[model samples]
Target: MAKMTLESLRKLRVEQKEAIERRDTGDKSIHIIVGMGTCGIAAGAKEALNVFLGEAYTRKMTNVVVKQTGCMGLCHAEPTVEVKMDGMPDTLYGKVDADVAKKIVEQHLLGGKLVNEHVFDYPARDIHKE
Candidate 1:
């Protein structure tokens, strides 16, 4: 593998820092990430992502941002979704389709209510815990 130069490393660090800062800040906007690996795509992840982005844009939700990522280690439950708001816990919704994505926008984003049945809330383990 090619070694990263000092400048390249610094740039990468800066980008990482920016992303973390954005996630940590008190922004009301929700971040939605659609897993887009082969399994996810085969399950219609792309359609879900498009629905999310389109709705966000149509509603003029400047704060809401949509992105795509690879497999989230849940191949059986492809087309997974990850939603993060400032105060609420990060929600992972699996088996998402366009309809599910629309409901996410309507119920979660607009209503500020979590769709409990669809959410998979894995507890975050603390590394410092004894």
Candidate 2:
């Protein structure tokens, strides 16, 4: 990658600031990925994804990006959600419902806190590797 010029750096700073504003003064926005494998779909991951999207749009959260992917390899923990923040390590939450999604947005995105009980800190496979 090339080093950013002063002007480019300023542009990046402005973009970051706008993202923070979209997050409502929260330091980092969230990237939410809902697992859509067979198990996950069976467990209602589709509904969870819809809930996140609805919340993002209704709240006008331009910073929060939501997406869908295949299996996370934790069939037991179906309906998984991968949450990524700017500075914090990624976290995966399982068995998510609309209510849980709302709480995640409130407690995690807004308050910058992790919901410990719902976090899946360990996975059998290394999905992060490329």
Candidate 3:
């Protein structure tokens, strides 16, 4: 066993504190959920998921989090992706492929525009509010 040193203890404490702080204040502003159920995977959800992850990394997008979920009960619309972002309606996009994933990241995430053609569901609101 290695003997404890004061310098080592202090360094460990600092590293732990920084890790805790990062976890506590993650504050990701955008959440992208890809359906990974059997139906989704068969419809190419894996590729879409990879594209999303790759785009986020290649583009250095810090405020976004991409994750996977089980079936959303929209099996007919496999490869669905639900995106939740501040100041925008939570949107579920259907038939998401690699191309659509790129569009979502570029046009929706970056340009703040919905890919209306692929949108399957979203919160209903009065048009007058817009």
Best by TM-score: 2
Q: How high is the CA lDDT of each candidate model?
A: 0.81, 0.82, 0.85
Q: TM-score of model 2 relative to the true fold?
A: 0.73
TM-score of 3: 0.72
lDDT of 3 by residue, 40-77 (tens): 99999999999999998777565678999887777788
Per-residue lDDT of model 1, residues 71-106, tens digit only: 777777778999998767788898788888899999
User: Across residues 74-126, which tens digit of lDDT does each residue of candidate 2 receive?
Assistant: 77877899999876668889878778888888888778898788888556547
Global CA lDDT of candidate 1, please?
0.81
Model 3 lDDT, full chain set: 0.85
Candidate 1 segments exceeding 4 Å error: 1-26, 121-130
Clashes of 2: 0
Point out the higher-scoring one by TM-score: 1 or 2.
2
What is the lDDT ranking, best to worst? Answer: 3, 2, 1
TM-score (all chains, Cα) for each model: 0.71, 0.73, 0.72
